[model samples]
Target: MGGNLQAEPGGIASFSISVRNTGNTVAQHKLTCASGHGWPVELGPSQSSTIDFEPLDILEFLPMQVRLRIPPVTNGSPPAGEVDMITCTVTSSNDPTFSHSEYANVTVSELKVFSTELFDLQGNPVGPEASALPITVETGETVNVSMSITNIGNIEIPLSVKLQSANTDWGMYLVYDGVIEYDRVTFNLLPGHSTTVQVTAIIPLSTFDGSQNAFSLTTRLDEVGTNQFITNGTNFLVGKLLGLSLESSGEKVQATVGAWSQYSLWLNNTGNGALNLNWSTAEPPPGWQFGIDSAPKSIDKLVSSEVSFGVIAPNLAAVGDIEQSIRVRVIGTYYNDSVEVFIDLELTVVPTLHFGLELAPETSVHDLPRETQGQIVVIINNLGNSPGGGNLSAIIVDGEGVEDPEWSLQYEHSFDELQPGEEISVIISVTPTADAGSGLRTVEITILGQADEGVIVTTSEVLSLGVTAESSTTAFDLSSIVSTEVFFSIVVLIPIILFVVVRRMRSSAKIYDDEGESLVAPGVHTSQENISERRAAALMEDVEKEDDVISGDISQFEIQAALVQSIGDLPPPGPAPLPTGLPPAGLPPVVLPPAVMPPAAAFSSSPATTAQDITVNIDDNAAQGGVIGSEQSSSEPMPEAGQQNVAIAGMPPVPPTGLPPGWSLEQWRHYGAEWLQRHSGK
Candidate 1:
């Protein structure tokens, strides 16, 4: 068996193990050891050792050894008997195997830490219970408070303090009194570093307080973790009261024109506040005017208490030194008063005039006929600022500047003083010879000195004296005359010649027949009736034919005859007899039925019709067939039979009244020519 050891009850146990190798071939051997108590055990190779066992927990112990291969020892001792049975092995080359095994024990402890510090401005330490300061103030007082904090801990501490007031009615309060909101800064503090903060508080008179008011301040540290601190200040007592007053300076007094006199007043603030005021004025005298100036007047805001503005007039007897009074009242919070002021003024009366003049009957005669009487009117006027009264006289002068004895007529009247704007009148009549030529005459008026000497004497400008001749035949003067013999001679001779020539032409063309019956050319008789119808055709064919030529010759003869006679003698002598017989040779016959013939023609044929027949038969066929007379044939075409019939059809039927047998062609031609000339011209 292998080496074994046992311990007796209540006794210690020891064991030894040995091994050797002496071969030249360098042999090796191993040794092992174990404990029955379960305590850690060790083994050795090629060495002898003894082991002792201690009972770990009151249990039996034994030692055992086993053999195992081992390398030779280098000269050092092996591990002790307390071996590490539960070994921590590392496979990495970076770790070493345990030569001996042991374990270490560890213990942990926690300590309290702080990040920020607290202190007062005077370097006084501020405890966690200290928060803010309290102070007392008056109505207008201001307060300032300053504070500082330090990093009391091993590490830097960040801190902030908030200040508040218990009473909001206090005018104003501040922390860091002079520091603006935007200028307050947050800072990082190093260990042992301290920062100072200022806070201010204010109380106003409006603050109502009999007791102290309290406010709180909090200081926080290391805002991240649960490290914080808080503090509060004691109550501050505040007490104050305010008072104010207002006054007014009366307005500047002024006046102007109105329906009647008027005045105005203004209440100006002259003290620290606004003011209300009352005002009034005195009545002015009659006819005197006054009014208030529209704009309000002001006074220095620091001086006068109240003022009055208005216009006034004193008693009439005091006009020399008239005075106006203005009343004013000051209505202010703490003051009330009234005052009257006098304004000096003077009354000035302006003079005026309204005067005019009126003349009695307003009319006068300048010049009259030799045996007629002429009259003159003189009106005196007091048209001035004063009355006028005086004696008046009148005188007349001829155009030659000689005073007429008859014009020496004088009219004097006693008159009362004419009031301003009054009038007076005076009259004077005179007789003068009507032989006065057409020229201006003068009427002098004089007023003897009575009311106003300067305006007394006066005279009118020249007056016209119209003189007319008498109605006697001797005064009618003829400017031109001619011998009655010459006048009558012309009057009788010219008419007779015209009459004789006209009668001769007519008698030469008078119709006479075998039976003495007159036959007027229908063409000549109806010419007037046919004028309008014939004019258009005639103008187209024979504008310059013999009928027109004869008309032109006749007009020339008339002009020559007019030159021989005066403009007064050109009307025809009398109405010509209507021709009743035929027209001269080469003219168309005019038929006369018994019903159209006169009673005289009923007994005998008219010479005009008989002659017209003879002339018509000679040229009727030729004329009816478009044969104009040899003289006009070259320039005019004869009318066709149809056109001639149309022309005849347009003629007016003859009236029942007919001409006598004595009528002639010349008369018919004259009447026809006159009618044709008038119609053509039209």
Candidate 2:
């Protein structure tokens, strides 16, 4: 027989047995199975389910093996001390009903389940992020801690929990209720089940407001190993600590040159603790004279204060437009906590120019007959420190009748090159057209000026002028001549009528007393031949007299005015010359023919040609007063303005025009230098 053994639930336990006929006689034996076995019995010798009537000779021994199977357990595995029964029987084949029986006990072994988790009194889970353990609590306050213990082993087990800490200074105790104070808590559990326990902790009035590590230790009832599975460390933040913040009034300021300015600076503390800041100002211009007024180095929490700074600019601190900046720096206790701010300042300066116009004698009015010419002089000046440049233009702004294009205005002039304190005279000329009506005219002379790079300033003035019409064939008044004829006829006819009426009434009106009546018919002509000779004597004496100088009301106009107009047309229609101012009758009229252009010759660089060979001879006779002859009618058209030819050989400039000419090269150079000037100006 084998001693009892141990096995888990639903497991097999095997043992060996010996059977023999110990009484010294032939015997038959049977082997069979019993309850508490894992599988059916299998005998080795016959490979049968059971042993039946096997012969056993005297003094012979037979060995057999037997097996018992353990039944399954449902709710949990059996405890180590738990046991079950297994029985076996051997019966005699002969002499039936004679048998022997045997019984054995089997025990099972298992491990205990042990696990734990934590929560709050409200049944909410607690972990490191919740900061539930080692919490900061007021003195004499008790807090309930909820924890779950789960059985994870295959058998029932009980757990012992205790508060444990490596630091001796932490003063707290684990409690089960109001009275059950202990170092640990105990609970029992079954396999695959759990139980929750409320663990209380108390803080003494002497506990410090700092950090401490708290944890729990658990041990199984049947195992010697321990687990430190519950652990956490927390920080208790409370009471007062140092903190700080900073602020300033503004960031920018504007100022002017040669002046002083002040800024009201403010600082504020936004934290719950006092702050101490060290502040300094940056260097300014030498005479800018920067100063900070009574700045405080310390400030209380939630408080604000003001600081002022000023920049006293010297008279010559800045002369041009510019910008500058000043900086203020504040240092705190820590390197990263410092605050530095900047204050930006600006300064400026500018220059000016004045322009004016003076029409000499203000208004120079001229009285000129129609077809006569005159001039007015004007001056423009600049009186400021700055030099100026601009353009000048003349406008015939107003008048009564139509302005004659032939002689209305000569030219517009410019004084753009005037310097400071400098004056320039522009000559304006007028040639009253031959048929112009009588009236007073006003003309506006405008000077549009600019100074210092396109700054616009303008000024203008009005000039008064007048014109008187001349009596001639083109503008003659026939009514005045008719009135003269009527006056003469009435004077003569009235005397004749009175004389005839008186002669009829008295019958004797005129009785001539012929007493020595000399016949001299108002100094009458002597003999016919003598009167003819006398007329010839008078004409000779008149032609011999010298020509007198007579300047018109508008003098020296046509010759002085630099007016360039197309001269292809003849003089306007007018009357014949007066007998008193006429030239001598015997001279032949001198006429100059137009020049023919040589092949490919331009006036600028043309070489000598056939036209240059044609010579002209002016008469030695002095120029006498000549009337504008009736416009000589011809079928041939006059030359165009650009095609007119000048400088023919041996031709003196008509009427000795302009400054008298000199034969020297220097004189010619000066004269011709301005020849192209008129063509190029605006």
Residue lDDT tens for model 1, 163-230: 56566664333344346442233545554456656555555556555545565455565466675664
What TM-score quantifies how close candidate 1 is to the native fold?
0.19
| Regions of model 1 farther than 4 Å from truth | 1-357, 362-369, 377-379, 385-409, 412-424, 438-682
Model 2: clashing residue pairs? 36-69, 37-69, 38-69
Q: What C-alpha RMSD separates each model from the true structure?
A: 44.4, 43.6
**Tens-digit per-residue lDDT, 1-682, candidate 2:** 5475776655666676677787568988887756453434344454444676468898676878765555444455444456666566778777577778777677765645455666643344556534553333334445566566777555767666665554444454555434463566666678767776555555555655453445454434644574434442233222222333334444444332223356677665533345567777777766556666777777775576776765554332333444666666554443344433444444332222344555667434455666666666676666433456656665442243433343566546555655556777777766667644343455555665566763223233233444333443447454322343565887789999999898898876544353212321222212332233334433453344467455666523332211111111233348422212122122211222212211221223322222222111211120222211112222222222223232211111111122122222122212222222221232
- Candidate 2: list runs displaced more than 4 Å: 2-14, 19-32, 36-83, 89-101, 107-159, 166-182, 186-195, 199-214, 220-682
Residue 96's lDDT within candidate 2 is 79
Whole-model lDDT, model 2: 0.47
